[model samples]
Target: MAPPRAEWLASSFACLLLYGFWGFLGKLALVRGLSSSQEAGLEKLGFFLTLPLILKPSATDPNAGPGLMERPKFALLAAYMSGVTAAAADFFYTRAMMKGDGGAVSAITASYPPVTMVLCATFMREKVTRNKLMGSFFTLLGAFFMARS
Candidate 1:
């Protein structure tokens, strides 16, 4: 039931644009004198506002998974922990953005993929190819240069 390559690519492109716009909007909000905590709280509220759309079964695929409350306890715990961690990260990220240049904050945060790569390689036994290593090195180098801006 996987989507076609075109669909995947289109969705990824949309994600890139949406995330970029989101950060830009968030920075604008911070510049408008909103407290970081208030920004984070309102952001979570925005996420909640979209829950219905996310949870509803779509026309193309009706076999949506079980309800969140109906899932296994372990699954529920994992989901809850994921939200908790994301909320904490969002709070810290907004705090950083509020105190520093948005571009620098964003550039530094964009380097997080290397951490994910390392974690996957260590915990999930994922292969780290030479290309991946080179890409990560370049990404980090770019982040370093941008963070100095």
Candidate 2:
């Protein structure tokens, strides 16, 4: 079953807000005394604090989930790749924000959904709808306008 449209929109918006703030917080931390490792440690601390609130208690079995030690090697590799991508994106974004026009850089980066959609279509055999094509066109237009301004 599909999620309600309003719920999907609300969740998307909330995720955007959370990541936006997270970026800002990370930048601030960098400006202050935190080294990259220290920043990562702090982020892990925050995750530990908040994860319990977000995860629902299991109805069938309480302690059935894999412990950190029990996670497989492939899962660790996947997690490492995820971290690498995140770090690279964050580094480039921060560099762009510092050197380039902030509004333009942010506008272009905010258009990532179209790129993601295209990638999904290519790799996951997802159908590209007319609406998605139109959205991609507008996203490119917005990025172009921002870059030009």
Candidate 3:
């Protein structure tokens, strides 16, 4: 039998919360004791360990196609760029948090989704619904208020 929609939604949301905390905690750990290169090495080691567990089933499955080694160079390039961007963002975020008020920095960072949505709408010709506009306005306002406090 299929799971209920609400059950799926709740489970997804819970997973998101857990994953978000996981990233945050990892960043905190990296910020605590390691230089960027050390942090990257540690993360790569963790990935090597964890990824194989997830990939093992697919590796054994006859229906699955060729492994990631068969993928084009551009795919690896894109993944590398993603990692670079994430590392840069984390470095800046940690700097901001350490230098300024965490609450204010968090508020400003939380405002990013609205700014991203606006940019996407402008550049990608994506539809900007009224509700989205209102949410963006409120997010900015809340961030502004938080920063002012």
Candidate 4:
């Protein structure tokens, strides 16, 4: 069965708020002279601490998800790749914040879906529909305007 729309909406809102605060707080930490990227390193360490808690398996859980150790090697590898990329992205984003406006940095970087779409199209043979093309156009358009200000 599909999840309820309200649940999806709430989750999306929560994600928006969490990411917004992440950018704000990361920039603030840099502004406060947390130099040498130790602050960003702690942010990555927090992800490490949360990963186990987030992936803990439960006997009575409805999904019957696999624990970290039980997951397939491929899945584990993929997850590790994602984590490494995220850590790199966060480090660069924090570094950018040290020299750029947080809002503009986020606005420009968040418009990266177009690149993803193109890569998936070329690499994974994904279809690029008209709607997605239009959306990508508008995303870049808005990002351009945002960066100008």
TM-score of 2: 0.64
Candidate 4 lDDT over residue span 62-105, tens digit each = 75766668878987898899888877887788778888888998
lDDT of 1 by residue, 29-71 (tens): 9999899988877888898998998776776765456766786
**Residue-level error in angstroms, candidate 4, position 86:** 1.1
By TM-score, the candidates rank as 1, 4, 2, 3
Backbone clashes in candidate 4 total 0
lDDT rank order = 1, 4, 2, 3
Off by over 4 Å in 2: 1-4, 20-79
TM-score of each: 0.82, 0.64, 0.57, 0.77
lDDT of 2 by residue, 18-127 (tens): 87777667657756767656676687689779988977666665565887579798878978998888767766676665456656777777788888898889988899
Report RMSD (Å) for each prediction in the order shown.
Answer: 3.5, 4.9, 5.7, 3.5
CA lDDT scores, all candidates in order: 0.84, 0.76, 0.71, 0.84
Question: Model 2 — which ten-residue stretch has the worst lDDT?
Answer: 94-103
Off by more than 4 A, model 4? 1-9, 58-63, 67-70, 122-126
Give the Å error, residue 92, model 1: 1.0
In model 4, state the lDDT of residue 142.
90
TM-score between candidate 3 and the true structure? 0.57
